[model samples]
Target: MGSNALINKHIDLKNKKILIYTGNSFGLNARRIMPSRPKTADGILRYAKYNIVGLVDSTCSEKNVSQVLPDLNPPNSPCDLKQAGKKIPIFKTIKDAKEKTSANVLIIGIAPKGGKMPKNFIDDLVWALENNFDLVSGMHTPLSLYPKIFKAAKQNSRKIWETRISPTELPIASCQAYKIKKPIVLTIGTDAAVGKLTTTYKLAKMANKKYNTCIIPTGQTSIMIEGWGISVDKCEGDFMAGAVEKMILEKEKEENPDIYFIEGQGSLSHPAFSTTAIALIHGACPTHLVLVHRPLRKRITGCLLLPVPDIKKVIELAEKTVIPSFLNTKVVAISLNTSGMTDQEAKKIIDEIKNKTGLPTTDQIRFPKDWTNLFMGTLEHANIRT
Candidate 1:
């Protein structure tokens, strides 16, 4: 989630302060029901160009963020570069974040269904624009589409960034992964928002300690963090895979990483996002995979009545679909999302997964060292060495 070494333009992120907006979703129950906002908040906290000063969640205002977000609690290290715990202040509105922290940017942290703006979220954006704060949105509805947001930005001399909108022109998919000699490993998931991006980042970080590696970010949050990546979900349906192919081929030419760790998005079983998921898998054409799952998850995040599928079925379906194109396509490791589970519960789930799948499994974000070791062993087994 750092800048690409090849990029020349640099933003002085350390000097800028950022405020995250979660609105009514910022409590224990909200963590499960509204995982996208909390996950986005944690990702920025772990790896962002700017400093995170406060979070806007009306329900949790005046409370310490460390107590609400499970990832920031004890036993799990902070994501800031300094590696120190900073008690982030929670505010009720964008105006509060502006007045208290003097934040320069407001990140639209929630990943809602259809990427639609929340009921009262526009009010917060209007207030931020009136105060001259730059707006960063990762939603399907671009801020430019709203006349009020557009006029406010022009009057305030502020910039509006819509990360989901793909570039106007993009190349077609060329199935380049088969032609390239370097190994490409993708981290996929059983359901959306189950720590696929986090696992990809952690794995790339670990691999870099011993091998030359780079990452392909597929989501809006990752694109912002990595400085360069194609937001596959935002692109036109036909061009999603090709845009991803172009990003990898271009990056490979510039950085020439020994291995490319492509970030995963959505799920094969997800009703709304399966098209993008398939496009990503085919575009990346990864030789091996790391399947991520959440043992406690009962249903798809957005669809309450849609029951979740078995982990085995998900893995089998993914592999069966890709075997014709990628002959050796197989899952090499497993990454579990065990946030809020007791130690014994987490351990039992991990052990059960290992026994059932006959593969290495761990709560990678909670215990990075263990994940690093497991992944390194997997790479060795696959004969993908530096």
Candidate 2:
């Protein structure tokens, strides 16, 4: 338990210096086309409380992380642009990374398509474990299951943190979340990987200033960022909702925050991940929902022929599907992922969506002030006391 040791406890990053293994997915093109693949690395680089010493990507070796992914240094970045450019170096391999920087932990930073560890990654993983560095991964394929990797870890006294493992004992969902009195805001998406986590995390950060806010991470990327969460996708179909409920109840007892922002997974309209979305809705029993959409994306991420429906229809689908079975969960706000659009284009679409849906809409990353005000305004309008 390297990173997973922080589960249900406060995170301690004093001694950990991370080296992110991004394989070949550490470039601007990957950020645009396959954002989800390098999401763990990007999230850690942007939001990790711990120190990220370097990155291991042969394709982008000798270049800094900021140079490879310039947009990572947003206006609100923790590190200044100039400092980040010189601080986090990228190396060609784990050995080079370790020799160059004091990174005692190696993180598998890509979530491949099928969740299986790529064959080419085995050698590097083994090398890292054999050395002094511990291993941390959010991939569905558990590194502990591999005999060679497990043996190397045991022999070297290194830890293997598999972030995607579900809890051993999970109670089946009995609509227990409905009993909680505090507002539970769930971020639902129009399609998979459409800024749901980013929206939830940013909103929680803003809300924490005025209210006691907690983020219930439902996916691996959020778990890596937040340090305590259950990856519901790794759970059995029947236990997915149960796992979510367990985390909510546990966090409620521990922190008792005024607001809990549950990071969403998948989409109700996407055939591949519809079940996870439905399970999250029924499990969290959210009082308010924030619908996240990528305005320019015509089709679902992996589906070529499946066209994304209109924003109005997506809102209608979410409300209709969740209201009848559970609490009166309304889609209170709209969070647009305006990644590839210019500011003018993003603003135009934001206004159009706001007019159409009659909801507070903005890109949280591009316009932090507007999003903060809009989110707080939406909460006040909904009578959710901050």
Candidate 3:
């Protein structure tokens, strides 16, 4: 089945009182130290459309979710317990969380390296399934494929939703996206897991106030948050771009948005994971690119031997790579992931990067007003309305 069919087949979030299973990686420290690991949980907490009752993380049990991650309380966040003026609670186990919050759904909230399910997590998943909680995971490891977990779900009449499955049918790319007249802004990165989704999401959210904007989710975490998207990284090598093109065309036909902000994957400079980046560039044929980088990260994540290339080089590579199919594509801005940096430090680095790359730069989450102006400027500079 294609992504649309699969999404329709599995997703049923209605009346779901959710309990996010983050295991040991569920705090602000873990998020700062390993941003990609708890991305699903973070994304859901910040932007999920469902009700998040509580969190299951043994290491941080008995603490409120906001106590552990203060920034999680965005305005009108689903995790906000507005009636009680309290944040969602965290429990050490699924049983405790479910009992306390009456949560009927369990979302696997980590994206470990290689998308592998750790033995402990697998045990927890089985327990949750047997106890009547439906499972939702954005990991590459499909919950439905696990024998014990699948049996438990079947016996308990629980559903399993996996977000990383690629479409069964995909056409080869013919540069179809270049035909779309609307401005398509793709968020490229210096390496994998460097805040591309967050930046794209924030930009699209801001742009939606004035323009009819769409966020094209391209990864598992993005798919979970957006409720529908192709996991481009899971697609076959030949059809990656085609899957993206299909999604864009479908969205255009559905929403007829004024602009598109595509979530990027991996890095064009990284040796271990560059195919998806190349596919997005060729497939989406974006008119504007926003480069996301972490100033402190000198080497590619998970590949110690490979150093990240300079900002200008990656920008030039992204812009020039599309020349054969799409002309005049530009890297319009720089999005710095200054997580763990002090205000002064973030400002200094942001300025340094802006001066070096000569592109408008800011940390989107920390400074939304600045990011909004920068993003709007990018749209105006690109001649994209609003």
Candidate 4:
């Protein structure tokens, strides 16, 4: 008896390479049937999401078709399911459909298999094409999702041409397949206007001097991260979990270094910035923290508060009042995010943080003439690499 396939009626897949496989289409009551593979794009094609029948069984009536159809999913943002009820397309033999409709892209969704695809399926498909079908293609349905079907595309004389499709070299096909294992160096920074990104960048640069540095969210945004000297291939701050996980994975794959120093994004109190605190809690979350502060503080009333009033009080507030309660860290390192803060003001904050926390204070990176070069452009001691 003949049967039909149900698929999205839109999106054309005529005269194009098509691959249909088995899976969600598999009916417990039905036997596993192999779908046809076509070479080159031809014209109209029809397919069933079920048993991979060599020559589809089209005798099955519409009532019989409904019994084997897969139900629809509750639509999300992109797949507008609310307005239009889902259309589960049904087709008899793939060849019959090729003679009927115009579909160029066939992304089939199927079930699981133990190992190899059944034999003679390729030859049977080639013969079908002789009857006027296009590239006997495989349906890349959900069954082949991720690593399962990543290597599904088999090599036959026809597929060998592929018009020259090249493979990419990234390791993370699935999170489990990622290839990094050592601690990765991280860096973060913000813009000079608020000084959050600026302070973070300076710290990242300093940390790079001693360790194999790694940059996060890879780009020239005022907010940036760097490792050793090379910037990361990519970076993003908006998605905290994704950013942290990516950095962790990236670092785990590289060579283990003495340490990883991650720069923060913004001022802890500033609505837009909490960079230092963020890196400490998320990216690097170091045992130590280099709190970059400026003498000039903008009050709610828009006034500039100077000398930070009393350095001792600020120190006491940071250690006893902060850290253990806020960041929950021992407050091991202190660094200045140099600002219009006079040298004396800078020294005061540094000394206060040190005396109170008993942590060492680090230097700051001032804005150089060409800030662009400080970012996108590469930087080296010139003599060291040469």
Candidate 5:
């Protein structure tokens, strides 16, 4: 499915004014910034349909958000594909931002490890609620958990949106997603920020032109863009698998697409998100796996002790240790993110990966047709109608 199909779901964010709360971690400063880890505020600023008035971050106050994170889409502006990003006003506090921009909603923009609320956070949340702004958070720490914030929101008639919480009525995993007679590709990565979501999104949009395909977003940013998805990483460990199963099963029944491209979360070897990865692999039970990686990245993000394993090793690791043991999952293709590499370097790296793993490979951003053609060939060989 595409954005047009999702927009009809009536998300109602078009006219809503929202202020993103990034706190002190809004820039590229190493001490406060986490470039590899996903930023909630960046996602909202990029994907949300709401009128994002400003960003609240005391550390970068008075500067524009684009000045800090040049990678993100410019706040409410159009630019060429390779053009410089635009800027959004930065404020020191949510109250100040609300007053300055007339924003009626406060969105938590920081996505810390474990999704825990920052130690010094409740005061600002309560302040926003008391001031009558509804709350939206992708954090695992729900606002309802804080008595003061919860009480204030109730008293002020404000709604709290917890994006990470899985639906209570999710079905238990029966592994039925794998039983459907269709191609299902899950994008797994060697580490965080390695382009799993981007690869999956591209595949969905491109593949659907010739075949019935739908992308299942499994992260907060992707969910925001797709307009519907459960953040599987934030779900309780025991229920994560079931949550994924339910999502895929429902989409299968509802859309009945010829193929499914499920977005992946963190790396299976990364300590912070391994559990979620395991749940995703078992839950989705995909027939083919597309491994995404940055060929030049040397280590697992946020961990100095763990080195990134070789691409072939990772493909072997997933097949031997995780997927093929239960289902017929193969690393059919590789999606390389060559953001900082030159054309020659990227081509050389792609050739190296293809030779090493004996898998079709492409830099999805630079040469989207490469991956799309690979998927088409796979479908044709499998005798699956496009």
Candidate 6:
């Protein structure tokens, strides 16, 4: 928590070459870091992705890097992409492309169609230049196997660029436990008709039906998920939940189950969405933490750090930060959007989480899964939304 602390927390970009690989779908999402003229339709950040040379698709061919990032063209375009993002010319392979271009950084980010990482627009440039992390995009690399990815990078003496900072504090006063009395769900979308809102509504209805609860609407103009408020701007992303969180807490009481289910506004990487997420956590402090990932996690963090980096160890290290003094409670449910996965895969991910950290696997839940109002009707607790 000192100047030295911030200085010590660096990306370690000294002088080394790196090659990051990710899976096809999951990995492809990582490459969507750069923007053409604007990353998002509404626009917020353009600086974070300036350093990315180009996106390369390994599934097609190794020489793709040169093709996509051609001396005159873009990088390799992935199989699932819509050709909307900027591309570089493909080379025989990244190695060959590097040999021709002499580029020091090599990263791979690919994910399945519609299952891409919802990461920041400027992730690649920021992490690549600021942090000493090498990038790669091969779905099976880190997930199933890809020792070569790290081995090659380590042999080149480059550290993977990914780190997370999670701060926890025991809430000062348990405001009120958020219970799903009637399953008041809310979804806000970037688009009007259907976007993330529809997805959120579906989730809410599915959960409500399983739990036998009523669905509440709380969007700008929607008939689904009933709520007392509707957020105006979707480009800003977090409006849906931010607006609803305040409303639910106002009406929630000890006797009634006041479950406020708000949808995340934009992709996680979207700067506005990221800002919105920060606001929602600080403003509402929901009983649960649900991250709607865009599948492009590798580009930003160099790894998908779920449950946010060993909370126990982090707590030990950051207790001095004093979160309990600000927020008034503890105990949270972290839900992940594992929409494109099988139960076995989900279980494996959960198991991996447990193996990496001592936290109970139950604390983290994968998406499209209905908990049936487990959080509701439990106990109402409040944190002094700081």
Tell me the lDDT of candidate 2.
Answer: 0.80
Full-model lDDT for every candidate: 0.76, 0.80, 0.81, 0.32, 0.73, 0.33
- Cα lDDT for residue 232, candidate 4: 19
- Candidate 1 lDDT, tens digit per residue, 39-75? 6666766666567888888876347677765456545
lDDT of candidate 4 over 1-386, digit per residue (tens)? 01221111122222243333222233323322321111000001111112121213333333222233321222211112221123334455555545544332233222122123334234434433334332322222211222212223221112111111111222221222122322222322221123333334444444455556543432122110111121111223333423444455555467444334443443334333344334234433333333444434434112234223343343343344232243343333344454446667666765675576564553334322223242212222211100
Query: Taking the candidates one at a time, how many backbone clashes does each contain?
Result: 1, 0, 0, 83, 1, 95
Candidate 2's residue-wise lDDT over 55-129, tens digit each?
898776447787765656655553332334344888888998888886888888887786788778888888887
Q: Which stretches of candidate 5 lie over 4 Å from their true place?
A: 1-15, 30-33, 48-51, 61-88, 208-212, 234-238, 321-327, 339-348, 366-386
Per-residue C-alpha lDDT of model 6 across residues 1-386, encoded as one tens digit per residue: 22211211223222433332332221223334422111121010111122334333344443333332222222321111222243433432444545544556544342222223323313332334333444422121131123333334444444332211111222222323233223333332211111344344344444544443322233221211121233322213334344434445554542243344555443333333334433333334443333222221233232233323333443232222222334333332323334346767766665664455433332113322333243332322333232
Candidate 3 ranges beyond 4 A from true positions: 1-8, 28-35, 74-86, 323-326, 384-386
- For candidate 3, give the lDDT: 0.81
Query: Which of 3 and 6 is ahead in lDDT?
Result: 3
What are the RMSD figures for all models against the true structure?
4.8, 3.6, 3.6, 22.2, 6.1, 17.9
- Candidate 1: RMSD to truth: 4.8
lDDT of 3 by residue, 1-386 (tens): 22222221466664678888988888766665666788777777776667778889977644887776556666633233331224788888898887888888888888899888777887888888778787878777777677777777777667778888887999888887777888999999999889888788777878888999998989887787777889998999999998988889889899999999999999998886799999998889888889999988988899889898988888888888873442688888899988779989999999999999888999877777798888797787675422
lDDT of 5 at 249: 85
What is the RMSD of candidate 3? 3.6
Ranking by lDDT: 3, 2, 1, 5, 6, 4
- By TM-score, the best candidate is 3
